[model samples]
Target: MSYDLLLTGAEQGDVAVRDGLIAAVGPGLPRDARQVVDVSGRLVAPGLIDLHTHVGPGYWSIDPDPIAWFSGVTTWVDAGSAGAYTWGGLRRVATESAVRVPALLNISAVGLAGRTGENRDLANCDTALAIDTIQANRDLFHGIKVRIDAEVVGVNGVEPLRRGLAAAEACKVPVMVHIGAAPPAVDEVLDLLRPGDIVTHCASGIASPLGPAVRSAAERGVLLDLGHGSGGFAFDVLEAQLDAGLRPHTVSTDLHARSVFGPVFDLPTTMAKLLAVGVPLADVLTAVTKNPADALGLPGGTLTVGAPADLAIFEVRAEQFSVTDAHRQTRTSPIRLVNEATYVGGRLLSPRLPAPPAPWVPLTRAQHAALTRRERHIRDLLATPLVDVDGLAEQFPRTKPRSS
Candidate 1:
């Protein structure tokens, strides 16, 4: 009866949202609601949760909220962007950020800041230091992540993973391993991982492909994740596996600056790719929502009453679109899912690329002052209406925001 908002989705009746939670899902939700979002004919589901993202202004990362929320991703997990040495920056973001951001601490001590061989030096796999870091920051970190590519492992091979698994064991959490590059091939990598441990980038195109070992691991309960990053995903790998019924348990874009430009433009784009490649829409939705939340130990990928009102409304367009992968492979599909609106705990967030100017409805002085009081940064940004010279210089040493 009394609620803040009401929403309607395809195959589902009117749903009521009240006090930052799903109040009910049925026909004729009360007309006394404060806001009504008639998303009828579209897909209304819990906000998407990205299991792997390199999110931040820090190294190997990018500003997660703007890129993530625009594409219907509400929760993001940073995969091995920070280690013991560089964990502070990410932790700070997680604490202050409105979106849910849990991370997998890197096994390497220096993190991904340096040139790519983070685990090349065997000494960097400091389980004790990693344990200390996890022990200190229990809220920020949920598990361990290690990239076992030949370049990352160097001569050490699977030792880094062994140590990383030990650290995860020490912290009593899950482990996510990135497979590619060899010496310690796919089978060897899967051998180190436990039942619940995650194997990211599962649709990798390589000589070994998804052999008996990978299928066996999945049969035994290991979670497969389609972490579609650069050189990590391929059309062939995904199609064969799907045809053979080796479906990935979760879908996540290895979202970072590089992948954001193409192949992995955003989460919806990746989901669209799966649908194009023959995955059922419902299964694709589950891969991005519930399955990820369950795997990452996060919350709110459901529309249950009293649950967090983190929801995403998507406009499913039946038109021609192109989906590409890291290997320059493309699959043209007839459907695309575009994000229409995102709700975070029932609060509507303003997007970065806002709608075209709407006659410039001026805000009253009192309203402006109150908004300024609530959001100081927006006030400052609009007041200047240009740039923050000093702040920009501080953040970007390589390129100045201004000539001076």
Candidate 2:
């Protein structure tokens, strides 16, 4: 078969495309038909699918393309930012977006107004309305989202989750529940979820002491997803779980306005954090790609013979990079995954995130200092680094040990 482009990576091959679907892929193929662009010496894989991101009409969400395209995520789901009362506004925004947006319908009618919790009032938990909203927009609606944080639904208890689970059952879709500090307890929330249901923020300290209930729910096929948001990821919590052999089914950045500036920068950075935490690189790749797509039953995770040519080009470099969790704990990794460009439906997109760095470019003083400061919270939360302020020029650099 003829080919359009060849992405030579660890899995080197010439990929062919016809009407958006990948027609064929192999080495030394007939370069017979169309335009051919060669990207040799890069890492190529399926476009990332983040199962949990908070993207709406920019209330809690950041403009998704700037964050997603830069991170090589072609598809993402806005966890719980719009509901029955605010769905129209978000729907309008999704229509104008550059990224492929799939949303998990929020249980609260008001969705996430400003940064306020959506499930404060018991009246906001409307199963009938949630079902109607999903039926209205079956193209965009994929599942149910309920943030069962203690602060989110103080007195409302787990009624929102109950309503969400009920709606999910009626709609025959999965429910993605956000587990935070317990008011009704984590086990009660776990009990309500069915197989294929997702429990996000599995690494947060808030969802503590997963003894039998979490394990039992996992045995029943309940999926655990990483939802790294502000105060949503803690190193100790993740280490404890990882040591106990609990891994996330999907890795997602709850990228809103709050997290885009620090800690939870983007999907690539989030995946890098998991790698730093000792998860295998292949495991990290699968969590962001196939696991999320399979969980949601999407059609474009793998580069199958007849699948849409959604792909991401990445550069994996070895450097002294550090990642900080929400609890102010830090970990460093020698291998960092950086996104270069992305393609959706066989068409390459102009990158919106900054272009990838050289294979081995050193970080500038300002850049290095910023990263060090972000992680130094583990040591002195109040104190600043004691570097020579006068010698901070890019040319006169000092190689200091990275802060943890």
Candidate 3:
């Protein structure tokens, strides 16, 4: 049978797509398709799923499409960028985005309108309202998110988390809690999480969650996620976790306005950081792909027949490359997964330039210079002609009038 599109000669074998789903996958499969792309020697995997990100309308949020076109992150989970009151705005974002945008609803009604202090009031963490919102918007929301830190919760401590958990429990969904500096200690937050709950920024340098509490939580099936935001991750903390036999279940870039420009550039860069920390390439791939999908129960994490046709093609360049964490600590990765193309539902994503950083988002002088240089380079390349005269073909050739 003919298919809509066929990917041939990929390392994962030929993949057939029809009706926006994988029709078949194997070696020597029928190549009868409307379009065929030869991707030999390229690593073709399910589109990367970022378990923790901010793509909704908020102070922290950024457009996911501009980055997704090149980063191969098909599913951008907007973790707590919106709450019950602000969900309508987030819903619009999901509707307009080119990639899939499932979200974890924030517990506070204020959401992330400002940088922090969403939960400081406690009146915003209305459990009943959160539960109702989740029930009403199950299609877009998968779970709940709460920032349990000193600054965010202020004197309230884990009360906001408890409210979030109550909402999640009522809705029968998991909760993804952001861990950071303490007033309520890390133990207080980790101990309250249920089996399927997720702890984002598990390797945070500021939080230092490397105690018996973290270990016990992991042992009890609590999933740990590497949410590498601007100040979330530290190389030392990750190394210690690796030494302790506690590998991250999923790798996610807390990709938002502030972090997108620097340390957490994209998902692949975050994966490379994992590679530098002695994680196997296969495990790293799983962390970005299947593992994150399973964590949030989203689709498009495998090439299995009947799965969504979202895919990422990468050139696995084997070379020494230096990758850095949020703390400016650097390490060398043996390979770099450079994305060649990203596809969603069998359609290739077009190139999109990201908007300038928000005014409130701070940038170092070096970062500012780099952004300027990149813009200049793009402008220079686009201003030049794509091809010369020889590359063009004349459609209508002038002929002597009526050789008759």
- List ranges where model 1 is wrong by over 4 Å: 206-208, 353-404
Candidate 3 C-alpha RMSD relative to the actual structure: 1.0
lDDT leader:
3
Model 1 worst lDDT run, 10 consecutive residues: 353-362
Clashes of 1: 0
TM-scores of the models, in the order given: 0.84, 0.85, 0.98
Per residue, candidate 3 scores C-alpha lDDT tens digits across 9-63 of 9776899999999999989888789999898999999999999999988899899
Selected candidate, larger lDDT, 1 vs 3: 3
Give me candidate 1's TM-score against the actual structure: 0.84
**Which candidate has the top score in TM-score?**
3
Predicted candidate 1 versus true structure: per-residue lDDT over 176-259, tens digit per residue = 999987877889999777888999999987523578888888988999999987668988988888877899899999987566
* Candidate 2 vs 3: which has more TM-score: 3
Residue by residue across 63-173, what tens digits does model 2's lDDT show? 777666668888878888888898887787678767778899999988987566678887888999999989888988899999887889988888989899999999889
